[model samples]
Target: MSTDNTLPIEHLRWDAASARGPRELNADATAAVTDPGAGRWAFAVADGVGDNPAAAAAARTAADAAVGAATSDPRGAIMVAREALADAPDTGDCVLVVAVGGAGDRCEIAWVGDCRAYLWAEGTLRQVTEDHTLAAYFRARNLPVAPGMEHVVTTSVRTAAAELIGTADVPLPAGRLLLCSDGVHKTLPTARLRTILERAADPGGAVTDLVDTAHRLGGQDNATALVVDRTAEHTANSSAA
Candidate 1:
């Protein structure tokens, strides 16, 4: 996913954490770019397909490129990121998810692959982006999920086409927001994530606990998490600074 529309958002706070898993190279990358002058912000996470060479580079390139483009055009940002990757053969490819907001109380989300975003509001934690893997497709249609289908993503930054991207525009809730790599979500359950968010001392601690918990729970993938609090009271305490 990519962002660059430069929508204006104000009085919000966020924090992020990432860790390499058991792999030799950490292929997960994250980005949080804020334009205080314009009150616009963008957040993203990319997981380079491990099978591809230079996966780490791919992840970083995808993330940075996405945020630096037409953020208002979430799907367009994905294309921009993809084109950027094509300029560097060494970068390979990655799956990504992103959220961009600032114009008003709404945010635009776009994704390819399984990186995810969630919204916590009104005492309910809800997943905002559905996974774009074959397993998810089968499950959505009430079909049987074949073994390992979850790992087979249908599209990615490098191979995206029309209709291949997933998108949603939501009212940026006033409670809490989360963007994370599969390593974190696939490892920690929703209930646990909710507890961590609700009990967190601040955004930084929530991100830290999320990643730390992933490792403690025997997660074998690179873990990455970004947490945001929009409530005025929590916002004061969770500044990205």
Candidate 2:
């Protein structure tokens, strides 16, 4: 009898980048939190209402609160974030997307407002969450969307009802997961975003390319990008080779 002795390596990885762009203050925030020994993690991105003086605070608060829920509780995390916001109106309002997963094949995603979550697989990028905006609402009914109405958000961390929160369960290990603010998506077209992600060497590289791409393209708002990878780049490269 022969005994095999090759132990598998474990690696959990994610990266994020934030830039002020043309704004005086960065109203965007990102968080990557882990629950040690629990085999679960959380990643979030928030876009603060630009008009509010406390927009940055709101963005940070929402992200921190959501990730602190300790595991992959997407909807419950959003609820915790909302309640946290309700307790501190001075922080203003923000839109957010939270993804909870680990080195697993699936993730739970929840969002309020326009922050977005996307999955990239084999050079294809698919948006996993919908924008809770008036534009989306009107377009859903086949109604003509007016100019600028697309920016009007229907729900947010500070104002969303329980039913207004959007939730999803997406396959993660088959690809990479991305959470980004509107600054990234609005400034970079879907094609451009996909190209950047496809060219990135890894999740950290992807974060830099995505955020810098938006800024270099003359973004008018704060930008943020968070990317999570279930598989190590070296492992994938080895398999490919």
Candidate 3:
């Protein structure tokens, strides 16, 4: 890791973990890349839609491309990932959430399908991105979220237009940024997740605990977690005082 003298936060750290669960193969991919000297970071989580033949490959392709481009252009990153996955051989489609963090308490998020981003700060947790699924669409329209409809993705990296790509700039509170696939979120409730995050000592521990908890609770799909934490650097005098 490098250092950024101008970043008000002074220090940043990130960690990630993934598990295949009881599935035949792990089709989830996660990545965290940081330009520490530049005070920039990129985070991504991708879940290969299960029906796809080459689900794992598609997930990796999207995750790698998104993380590579997110530092400079988040939306462009998703577009590049989409175009790359389009050339995949019979891989079907995948849902993704990509985030870019800059100098201060602000980050930009781009997503398609049901992958999600959440912010946990000051002992409170809140979801920052909405799911792009049939169930979510119905819920938005005041219609019933039919059984078995939650898994039906409305748009994905392989399908959504550039304009259809969802993007948001969120203010980071004094805690952690979490990105995860449905495998983890679906199996664990929000209250349980908040408790796990709050008790973990560091980003690495938080991710590990989250993934493990997902499996222990019966994860039916590949699970992945990525966490980013930023803190202000304190001088010796300040520390002692």
Candidate 4:
């Protein structure tokens, strides 16, 4: 994503990992990286919607497009994925989540479907993005979910316009930021995840441990995790240092 002078380039480290769960033939997709020049990081995760053969490919393409366009508005990133999806008509529906942050002590998210983003600060982990599934909608309205539609997503990048998508902006927190697919969050409790994240010393270890934890818990779909650390005790390029 694009970053201005206001974005912080130091004291931030990030990493990502993805794995195909028991039922999927291949892994979904994930991306995370910092822009050295502009001092911003773009993060994304995508899961293919159904059993369509092209689902995996769709996830990869959508994720790439989303992160690539993150430099501008989050909506612009989602719209770019929409255009890419239209060009590849055989791709299946997919859920997408994208987060962009710079030096301003703030982060913005754009999402479609159920992939999620969270902020873990001061030992508390809170969801930052809302799920667009029918189940979530019903829960938000305090109504019972329709039978067999709990998993049905209300919108997707390939299926909705920019205006119909979801967006959120939150101040950067003192701890770790996580982006994950349903496979990971669905299989593991947030309390347990907090423990894992708090213990991780680096993004690579944190994400790897998360994927493994989901697998150990019997993930039924592809699982992915991305971690961004803004704590002062660490820096993003320490590995390279």
Global lDDT of model 4: 0.80
Per-residue lDDT for 28-134 in model 4, tens only? 78865557677667878888887556888788889888888786577788889888888998887688999987655688998998888989888888898888888
Which parts of model 1 are misplaced by more than 4 Å?
1-9, 51-53, 233-241
- Candidate 3 global CA lDDT score: 0.83
lDDT of each: 0.83, 0.81, 0.83, 0.80
TM-score, cand. 4: 0.88
Model 4 stretches with alpha carbons more than 4 Å out = 1-8, 233-241
lDDT-best of 2 and 4? 2
In model 4, pairs of residues that clash are: 1-71, 2-71, 6-103, 7-102, 7-103, 8-103, 13-236
What TM-score would every model get versus the actual structure? 0.89, 0.89, 0.90, 0.88
Overlapping backbone residue pairs in candidate 2 total 0
Q: Write the per-residue lDDT of candidate 2 for residues 18-84, one digit (tens) a residue.
A: 9887788888888767754565678889999974569888989999998888275788888898888
lDDT of 2 at 108: 92
Q: Candidate 3: worst 10 consecutive residues by lDDT?
A: 1-10
Scored against the true structure, residue 60 in model 1 reaches a CA lDDT of 93
